[model samples]
Target: MSTTPDRVALVLGGSGGIGRAVSERLAADGMAVAVHYAGNKGRAEEVVTAIDAAGGAAIAVGGDVADENDMRAAFEAVETAFGGVDVVVNTAGILILKPIAEFDLDDLDRMHRTNIRGTFVVAREAANRVRAGGAVVNFSTSVTRLQMPTYGGYVASKAAVEGMTLILARELRGRDVTVNAVAPGPTATPLFLDGKDEATIANLAKAAPLERIGRPEDIAEAVSYLAGPARWVNGQVLFTNGGIA
Candidate 1:
């Protein structure tokens, strides 16, 4: 919400379902976007193409959020393409759902690497580099509040993100930057729907007060609001879960 006109935004994980939506929404809102992806270069290019077709400026960049060098290169690429970045939206994360007792240690490592460590790396970079009057929007999950079974690992990772967002918001006090997180509920993304049966998915959708699963755009709308106009909304986790949490 603290962004300036003609500002640039870097969307980490811009190739995924929610990430693509966030990239498009930010572009529509008139911000030149830097679309970042880790493994999906083609999908990242697709997002860039859409933005360009809409007469918006965008470029696709690749990096792993957990690597300092990778994120540094990503930021450098954004600056090279759009002068300097004013907003950073970190949607790059992994969700590994399993009972704690049976959860694979390797899976735990992967989730932490991408969700917690990656978020910290990106947030630290944003804290030091983003221009004044900028905004940093991180991703969390509503499962933290719902405490759903088999979501222990994923929720724990996002909880780290939430804590970091609050601390960073205060850390950016004199710099005129706002840091927040968007906690979305069960959304209809490939990541969320991959292995579910029709009946199970329908039941989950009906559980929300809205009686439908979230769309990526629904979450993107929240990101757009926090990134552009909600100047006083720092240090908050805006949940876009349709009242499920």
Candidate 2:
């Protein structure tokens, strides 16, 4: 394979499962990654150390993705570290499951704060700071399509993410940046499998044609492709689910 150019990426929530995988994958693919974490600096540092051990470049940055000033500083830190950023993958989010009638207003607010407003803040910074030919990848969940009963609030927030992703692509018409979302199905992450029983997990896995849960690496592969070489794929929500639809 030909060598990849010197590129930089800032992955929000890079300390988490899917985010960490994306951080490692992008670094392996020859990009200097800025691993951004909201509350887990140690985990972010671990990712950076692992990348460095593998002869790749990475740095740990911390901030609230919902805070504009914080996210702006993050973008600046990445630019200062690696010249400029070429890709931004926002994996920062929160999940609270409850029936619509049983949902606490506070829970709905929190979910929207991270998943909706947080995405806008991150995308705003990326829109202004990312170099030409860069890509912005946001995260969504396949639950929006599955339309499960208890997923009302969670699915609502992701629907907003999908809307913004497509609109942002149109807004960046001349800048050559691709804006997209990755809506992953049931993945085997701590955040995903936390409260579920084995039986429930098995049912979800079997629902998909692949008959298995998605690995963090599987979603990371999609992010890597969009960040590096999937230029023609713009303004779309790529469902990395195993044919769950």
Candidate 3:
């Protein structure tokens, strides 16, 4: 791909399944990347090492995404190493599935803290810090649109993400930073497949027109577009779900 040596990106949750893909993909495209992890230092280091092995620039940053001070430090770490951050992608999130009544209130609070509060903290930092012509990409879920049962709390958190994304885009005005969210359908990741049976997975996979599950790379491609050349595509949720409506 084309390389832009001057560009830099910070991928929050860069140690996780989809986050790892986005970190690697951004690094491959020649953006100096900061791989931010909440806990998995080894996984984050592996991602950074892979990028370096591929002749790309990357560093691993650790912080609590929902903590303002922690996120600020993560941003500072990137800015310190990369001069300035051109793109900020918040893929750090939590997913807990259960019927609304069946859900423990503490679990709901935890999900809200990570998924909603975390995005707010990251987006606020990106809003104040991202250079002109930069981008802020947030993660949402197709469950919001699909209205899947047992996903009420998760969907609620992501729905808050969608609202923040649109409002942030408008708030940026002429700042030239495109704010958007990517909503992906069921993907083959450990977090998603943990308790799911083959039959259930197959059914969800076939629900989409593509008749298969999405890959992390597939969602990363959408993020790449928003972060790079899709200047006019702002204030929208791009559902990269392979025609799953």
**Local accuracy by lDDT, each model:** 0.92, 0.93, 0.93
lDDT digits (tens) for residues 182-205 of candidate 1: 999999999999999999989888
- lDDT digits (tens) for residues 1-245 of candidate 2: 11233788999999899999999999999999999999889999999999989989888999999999999999998887778989999999999988999999998999899999999999999999888999999999998888999999999999999999999999999999999999999999999999899999999999989899999999999999899889999999999989997
- In the range 1-245, model 3's lDDT, one tens digit per residue, is 22335899999999898999999999888899999999889999999999999999999999999999999999998888888899999999999989998999999999999999999999999999999999999999998988888999999999999999999999999899999999999888789889889899999889999999999999889999999999999999999999987
Candidate 2: give its CA RMSD in angstroms: 2.2
**Candidate 2 wrong stretches, greater than 4 Å:** 1-5
Name the lDDT value of residue 48 in candidate 1: 94
RMSD to true structure for each model, in Å: 2.4, 2.2, 1.8
Query: What's the TM for model 3?
Result: 0.97
Superposition TM-score, candidate 1 onto the true structure: 0.97
* Structural RMSD, model 3: 1.8
Q: Estimate the overall C-alpha local distance difference test score of candidate 1.
A: 0.92
Candidate 2 lowest-lDDT run of ten: 1-10
Query: By the TM-score metric, which is better: model 1 or model 3?
Result: 3
Model 3 stretches astray by more than 4 angstroms: 1-4
